[model samples]
Target: MVRNPGRRAALVDAAVEVLARDGARGLTFRAVDGAAGVPNGTASNYFVSRDDLLAQVAGQIHQRVAPDPEEVAAVMAAPPSRALVVELVEWINRRVAGDRTGYLAMLELRLEATRRPELQKELTRTIRAARDDDLRFHRESGLPGDATAVRLMYLAMTGLMLEQLTLPGVVPAEETQGLISALVDRAIGPEGAA
Candidate 1:
């Protein structure tokens, strides 16, 4: 594969756009090249196959949506509680709200994975790693939760995000923080006295 980080990144971003707008079925090398505004076959040069492109897109989605280091540090510095968990959920929700396209592309990747065992394995591995990381962070941050609690929070947030993104009026944007707060409190509990 070509080793031009800048170009490769651009192509991947373009692929994300295409995937979000057109779904996995519409994600093709030519479409990505066109979306990237590069010459024909540029995407193919960067990604050898469809699965390669999809896998890279999976990795890129996490990179694009991850919280900034400073934001993470600030949160981690605070005493852990349901409120802190709510804050984290709100942070992620804000990102999803701001970049609906990227989140949609991620959902598209999930659907595509269902039909491709190779991609499914890759996604399962990556998602497992992320879940494990979340568990570790929860423990280190003194968050009042176990792995199962974390998983439940993840599911709830995912559902909330999907509804908010897919059916905008289904969950009022202004109420999202409150909803997250409620979910987190229900899943964990009130903060310990600081």
Candidate 2:
């Protein structure tokens, strides 16, 4: 494969855009090259195959959608409480909503993974690791929830984001914040629990 990190990253990012806009079937080396504005065969040089490109895109989307360390630190500065958990969950929702393309690409990857065992395994590992990290952080940060609460929050937020991104009108924009607060309250317990 190509040893140039910057070029490889650019190609993978282009692939993300293609995947988000055109779905997995439209994600081809030429499409990525066109999206990246590189030579026609440039993507093939960077990725051994379409699956490799998909795997790299999966990793990139995770990084793109990950929480900023500074933002996490700022949130952590607050005393742990159910209210803080609600704030954290809302922040997460906002972050994902802001990166619509990346999240859409991630959704594409999930759909494509069903047909490819390797891709499925890779995504499973990637997502599970992220979930494990969230569980660890929730415990260490003294967040107002247990592992079960965190897990439930993940499920609820995933569903909420899916609906909001793919079918925005279903949730009604004005009610999103209220729903997020309720999700946190129900999953983590009452505001005064911790």
Candidate 3:
């Protein structure tokens, strides 16, 4: 396989597009190559197999949607509280909203994982690790609540995103901010902590 980082990244990106538009079953090497506008077999050269492509798509999406360093630094500089938590949630919501395709690809992977035990195990570990990271962040910030709070917040945000992306009008756009604010309030407790 070629060691060209740029090319590999492009293939992964194409895979995400395919996964989002066609779902897991359509995420083949040829499909990625076509979506990437690369030569036939190019995707094969970059990814060892479909699973590798799926994993890379997940990684690329994570990187794409990760908070900006400047944003994180600014937030970190402030004291952690319910308001901070709300801002963070809003920031994440905005990012995910902007990258609907990437998030959709991620959801597709989740469905695909259900039928693939090995993929299911890997994704579960990855998701758990992300939850751990969030829990650590909350703990370090001295935010209110504990790991359960973090987990609940994560669940709320995921559900919100799913609705926002799949059936946007199900919850009016104006109500979303209010709903998230309430979720954060409850998740962090009466003190707005965590």
Highest lDDT model number: 2
- Model 3, 158: alpha-carbon shift in Å? 1.0
**Order of candidate numbers by lDDT, starting with the best:** 2, 1, 3
Q: Per-prediction TM-score, please?
A: 0.92, 0.97, 0.91
lDDT of 2 by residue, 63-173 (tens): 988988998899889898888888898888888888999999999999999999999999999999999999999999888788998999999999998998899999998
Candidate achieving higher lDDT, 2 or 3 = 2
Give a tens-digit lDDT track for model 3, residues 1-194: 79999999888888889999999999999999999999999988888888888778766776766778788888778786677778888888888888899899889989998988877888788878877888898898876667887899899889988898889999878998898888877876655232
Give the TM-score comparing model 1 with the true structure, all chains together. 0.92
lDDT of 1 by residue, 101-185 (tens): 9999988888999999988898888888888888888887777877788899999988988897788899988887777877777
Question: Which stretches in model 3 have alpha-carbon errors above 4 Å?
Answer: 191-194
Report the alpha-carbon TM-score of model 3 versus the true structure: 0.91
Best by TM-score: 2
lDDT preference between candidates 1 and 2, better one: 2
Clashes of 1: 0
